[model samples]
Target: MSDAVPLLPFVRRDRAMRWAVGIGAGWLAAFVVLLVIAQIHPSTAIVDLPYLVPIVVAVGLSFAAAWKTSGRTRIAWVLFAVSNLLWLIGEVIWVFYTYVFQRGPPAVSVADFFYLSSYVLAVPAILVAIGSSGHLRHIRGLLDAGLLALGVGTIGWQVAIAPSLPHAPRLADAVAFAYPLFGVATVTLLAAVGLAGRHRLPAWAGLVGAGFAVAGVTDAVYAYTIAKQNIDSNWINIGWQVEAVLLGLGAVAAIRRPEPETRQRDRVRDLTAVPLVIAAMSAAGLILADRLDGGPITGGTLAILLALFAGVLARQLLIIRDRTRLATQLRAALREQERLAITDGLTGVYNRRFFQEMLRIEAERADRADSPLSVILLDLDEFKKVNDGYGHPAGDTVLAQIADRIRGSVRAADIVARYGGEEFGCLLPGVDEEVAIEIAEQIRQSIGRLEVAVGQGRSVKLTSSLGVATAGTRGGHSLDDPDGLVNEADSALYRAKATGRNRVVAAGMLVDPVYADPDLPIGLVWLADRIDAQISVHEHSTAVSRWSLLVAERLGLDMAALRRVGAAGRLHDIGKVMVADSVLRKALPLTAREWEDLRRHPDESARLLTELGGRPDLAAVAAAHHEWFDGTGYPRGLAGAQIPIEARVIAVTDAWAAMLADRPFAPTLTVDEARVEIERGRGTQFDPAVADAFLALVTAGMIGALAEPARA
Candidate 1:
């Protein structure tokens, strides 16, 4: 039902507006030439006919622009086009009366009807545009706009209107007075709307507003001169012609679409004192003019000055009140933001960062009081299955319900937090080992009772595994370090998962018994002992497995290939057990025979894994990892794609981990140096594609945390 039209067919619109602006500019120039010639030759038909050119072109361009404008703003453009058409009609009527009928312009003729109707339509058009922008919804904006309008209107009334009113005919006098009054109203509304909208008027709309203001000023001056019987002023006619050109250019601008609005800080608000000073100067000038004419100041002039002063005071008061209210609102908003930062957005509980801080504080307090402090880490069993079978939303529902149960099962003084994805941590102050285990059992049983609804009339029953660790209970290492407590709990949680789940396990508790193989090989047993002697062999294997899988994914390998890469990464150094311990931990550069001895480990690793059975693919990858991309490596000289892709991926990950890790022969490299080493070996010692993928992961910051050297 809106009058909005889409501003499309852009090429045509642009060309049409350009032609309109060019022609309008030319018409205005010709009008200037005609005025100069008229000063020497007096009245002529050439001047009369050319005077109508600018008006016709302005009206046509306005209608075209209105047809192209879109959105809610199209209503204002439509109204503006209608007003211009009305002005054109009025101009035609005036030309007919002056040149065709051979008579002077009439006082209240058909021309006056159309001319006055244009102003009537224009005022509401501007009001609708301002309303559509939604800037007037603010009370402060409305108040500022009203005060500004009042100030500017008062100045216009005193300077232009009152003096011409005393000596004219009844009809001419009425028309003369109406011109200045309408001029004041139109200019005030334009300025007020601009200020109310945060001084961010659209360029086309601002141009139109200025054009209307200029036209109003020219009309007032012409009306005043005509009432005093001086009607042949070329300057006044030239002013009217220029107003038409201004409006035409505004129409051209309107045909082009505007960009999306952004909130920009306006500097124009800082110049508010300019208007106040102008109003003060107008009042002072009026008083001085009256005294120079040998007359006392009238009561009307005094009342106007008093109203201006009162408006100024009210404006200042509004500004102060609005600023005070804004400050209060800002403080409340900042408090809410801080609360959100510490709380989980989805689960509505304390988050990981807040939980860590609270754990440190509680540990310090317990140390001072010489009291026992305990922590319980809980993890949901088979959480991935819940996400895969039902949906992620269902998984989220289960997590929230579990979080609620954990909160309810703990004491009032306990702190509960969602640690990270399906894991929750609870801090218990002043609790011994037995009480902490009792609380953990209660939480496990409570979570085991939850049945969450997961849409489509189906429900899921959930269970949780919990681990409890108390400070000063297991060698008292947790009292010195809060993170030590977390690790202890995490280990117990893993044991619970390894044994049957959905139960509680406390730190230092014995793991469930399983059968031992009597036929296990002594060589395998020796390998296990060496692995355990390396303090973080298990942690390094985990990091290498994760990094290899990521690189395999980037290379577009399938799931089976990914599994092979992970297996090779974990068992890459299994053959090192066959070498002597003295040779492995030498702490200096090796001799030729020592280097050959180390190089034989990869082939030994392949043979050992093959003899173990059902792991031939893992053995092959581990063996080929030492092969080079350029057919120059030991054990085998496979070149380019002749080597297995999984082995190539493992080769890059193994070198990356080794360079970043501390070893007996060399210190660990910095991250930047490690990256440079990998890049240097591309296409020579490492596959180029695999090296690029590893470097990409490093650049994305995905491997920085894993790049830390394993602690011994």
Candidate 2:
């Protein structure tokens, strides 16, 4: 009833309600006039016409309400129309008996059947209207409705039904008793709905409830009068006319535009509870009265009580179940939200935030236990090419696959995370430098083997560069700071990219620039300056110096010879500073004249080192780095042993670095391709002995060790 209030300006609502009241008053006045005329004339024609006219008008108004309302309200309106139509049919039959047959209708006749059926339709119509109004979802509301109905029905039965039941025939008595009981049930249910709703009850709903109440009281009076043989009364007809007019007014009120209802929870303090308690007390009193009369409780009475109890219990159980289900669903929703917060949306791996927290925790634990903790930072080589050439979708596919492989490759104790775009981080607790490097190498090789399908029939091979850094090593960077440890690993990663792709570089092998001696020989210091000028170069001179020492030692060179070889390797590309930046940064292949100008770098390096008072042996070796073993190379074309062994070693290491390192002029080559190139030039461009020593070091896995920073 509360849900049916029209949402309009206050002034408008007041005017509308006043208009409705006026119409209702006018209709009542007309009824009074017809009733007076009937009493004066006492003609069947006058009685039938006045009685039928108001009822027909009520039915028409109900149909109009049904047509105007929408959604669930329309259904309620239609049911109201049906009930009014049924009432009209009952009245027409009564008129027929009076005018055509010239006799009164029987008490339990077809007219009574139609009248009873109207109650049947009207009761559900009111209930549906309340239910569809969104006020009955609470368990308290249902309980309130049931309790009120039980109490009201009991009171009505005692007052109206018991007294007249013994005087009438069994069938007629049953029909008369059922009418008031049905009316009580309908009125109680409607009142409960009104009380349970948070908003004010609608005027139309109240009028409808009033109509039902009037009709129920009228039925009770008519029955009692009939049983007492005093039923031919104008007052009974007046009651019927009032009920019809009330129903008609209710139907007209239904067309008012409904207000937007403010929803609230029903409280226990509502006055509806008082009536329920009083009705219960009344029913108990009746039972006591029956006991005092020595009337044993019948099976029907017991059955009714048990049925009511079962209904209350069922409603309670359903409420409990619904609450439990809602709690479980809420818990699951929270867990899913937490998971989404920590996981990468594209790859489903731990994202940067989670990884950072985990790394900090692991670092603290490792520092406390004096255990090794390592981090491996990996970046996909040429990832931008995948995005540019194959499209972002293909790039995404490659990223997901790479993350999957990293997860599968690492041990369960290790944490793998997507650190950022094209970069991944792994935290390995209780892993040392050697083991971390081994794991990183495995990741590098595995990524190299990946052939991701971009689209069409085309596939692209992918590769990665990894850097390994361990904490808790003597004389190494501190592990107590997680950010410092990560920076160390990132530095090693930068070196890996600088020296070559598709390989792993260890933090222990990274050069400490702060510790570099300022008083170094002029040539080496000058070489460092030249290397710093290049944008694409990354610690290449340092890598070459380290590789040269490794190769010279492997070939059994003496300490003095090794020193010269290492110096020459470090200064090998120092003359590149003298070359034009345009030629150095060119993307296309160099022209023949540009190549000729490039060929003079070796001689220029020798001249600069010699003038700077560097070792003559180192300078001579740098000058002949391009001299071939077959005498088909460089400025002098010196072949075989004719080329200095130091120069030959530098040439092999320099070529390897150039092949592995990224350059604007050419794509980087894999380690296997570099090895093949080195092998192919063994006799023609490389000293056989130096080349053999280098390949032996590779076979023995010493090259990977040399790729790391020199341990203190």
Candidate 3:
């Protein structure tokens, strides 16, 4: 595949392909240019034929590199590499024999063909330093420049000198102009391309293209000397030798140098017009000084002043615009931050701080203008007990619905805030006692009729208690008082709560302060007991959850992240409330139908927790608890880790728990017996890691809670 393994330290398949493509493209381009060189030197058969063997090596390497790396990438690109190598071969034959043995002095012979043809191998050596990307990056532009420059040079030189002699070779006629013009155009183009890009490869390629720089200079000197018929012209070979050195320099620079990072920065700087600015300034200054055209002294001075002023103004304008844009951006950001500060994220209501601030504004306004303003106080009944019973998620839903209903009933100008817990406050602008009471009643009734759903088909019928108070001007003096009004409204609210919630009461000029009673941790000890109870749950739940986790861990998932799987796994069977205890504890064989119905624990567990304010992510895991790694084991036959990791862990743990716990249908097994059962199930039903961990736990005396103590 490699033709031979590259012994060069830098050799690889990539370098091989790059060299092949570059040589193929370069030579093919050279041939097209050589056609122009041929025309200019029709009689000079050799025309020095500078580029040949490089073509054949390209073709040869294309085949070799393609074979070497074909298996790693697409076969077609590899084949393309082979084609490049073959093209190199064609360039070799044309360079030496046909032209060298023909005539035109320099003592050339056809015998030098093989000796010259061997020079193509130097390319692969270059590939040792620079890789494939360098070749492909440069070759196209190099070929194009060579063709265009050679074509132009041929035409220019032939036209300039061909008219002098009828039988003279075009090379003698065209060499003076042909060599220099073509050389300059090609080298300059390569330099331009190299300087334009950011990638090191392009710049390197450009520099390599400029490698022909010295060759062009030598040809120019030689043509001039030969045409002059100078006898000692051969002594000028010393200067011409410099051209060969430049060629080698270009090749070495292209091969040894890495891709340039400056290419991109240079282009961006160009686009920025920094140079253009300098050029414009220089031209303006020169013109003002009367360098290009005649001008009155007075007018020249004015123009110079105007030009300097304009440049300074433009620079200042750009700086000012950038600063202004930054300031506007910062202002907008602050406005958004302020807006978020006042709004409740969950229910989109005015929060406590904003509501209080707005109330102060409206109350002061009402007092000054001799206008009426009323305030309403409200609280949802049994809010805390509902949270404790159904879970906090359900409590949040109840609060959200209460806010929605109150919002619908209040005036557009009214301000509302969550006072605390289930309590809320509303400030009514331009409304008196009667209107406030009506609004408060409407809100109370609306909330009373509302139904917010929890898990399963269960829904909560929400109700709230409301209190209303109003203040207005009396005898041209504003009779408004914020603290007094709030207190009266609160007293009325307490009255409603006292008389079985879901009703509203008017303050009716009463202004006694109302103190809210404290509600403590309420059931802290009960919660503690609940937490302690879970230790037993963990033991039984571990039978399936741990096993499922082990299987999932050994199967593929990271063992560390298995906490989600483990937590879900541990709680997998919490839904047994729906399964009859009779069925769970039955000793005899279950009918096929009973077994079918018993597998519904995961679904029931998920539903149960959802009602209990469980996290949605945890609920989802519990729902799929019975699922197994293999599609064969489940209510839904999912295979190959298709089951949730949590479900798999829980499934294994559930099995372990059932085996160890006393059972009517089967004798309870000790930890060791349970471990054996799991090991027998590896790959079939249990995960290997799960079985091993369980056995290890038993063996390491970690089975204190797992095994019953023998009686003395």
Which candidate tops lDDT? 2
Ordered list by TM-score, greatest first: 2, 1, 3
Tell me the spans in candidate 2 whose CA falls farther than 4 Å from its real position. 1-11, 14-18, 36-70, 78-99, 111-128, 132-147, 167-169, 191-287, 329-712
Per-residue CA lDDT of candidate 2, range 25-77, in tens? Answer: 78778777766887888765655667777678789988998898776667777
| Model 1 error, position 297 (Å) | 7.1
TM-score of each candidate structure, all chains considered together = 0.57, 0.59, 0.33
RMSD of each: 21.6, 9.4, 25.7
Q: How high is the CA lDDT of each candidate model? A: 0.70, 0.72, 0.52
Q: Between 1 and 2, whose lDDT is larger?
A: 2
Model 1, range 1-712, lDDT digits (tens) per residue?
2222223333245776567566777877878888888887888565777878877877887887778776545677688778888988988888889887798567777887787778777766666554324432233343344444444545554565556556534776566555554555566666655554444455566667777788777877876686566776766877778777877777777766542231223556655454466566767776876788798887866876776677667666765675676688799999889878888877877898988998899899999988999999999887888888888998898888888899998888998989889999999999877678778877876776677888998887766777888895545446889999999999888877764466566775433211011232445434633553563332354456557876886788876786677666666677777777767878888888888898898898888777963467778887888889998986788888988898898888877777777676667788899999999999899988899998987775445333221111
Residue 535 error for model 3, in Å?
46
- Candidate 3's C-alpha lDDT? 0.52
Once model 2 is optimally superposed onto the true structure by TM-score, how far is the C-alpha of residue 157 displaced, in angstroms? 1.5
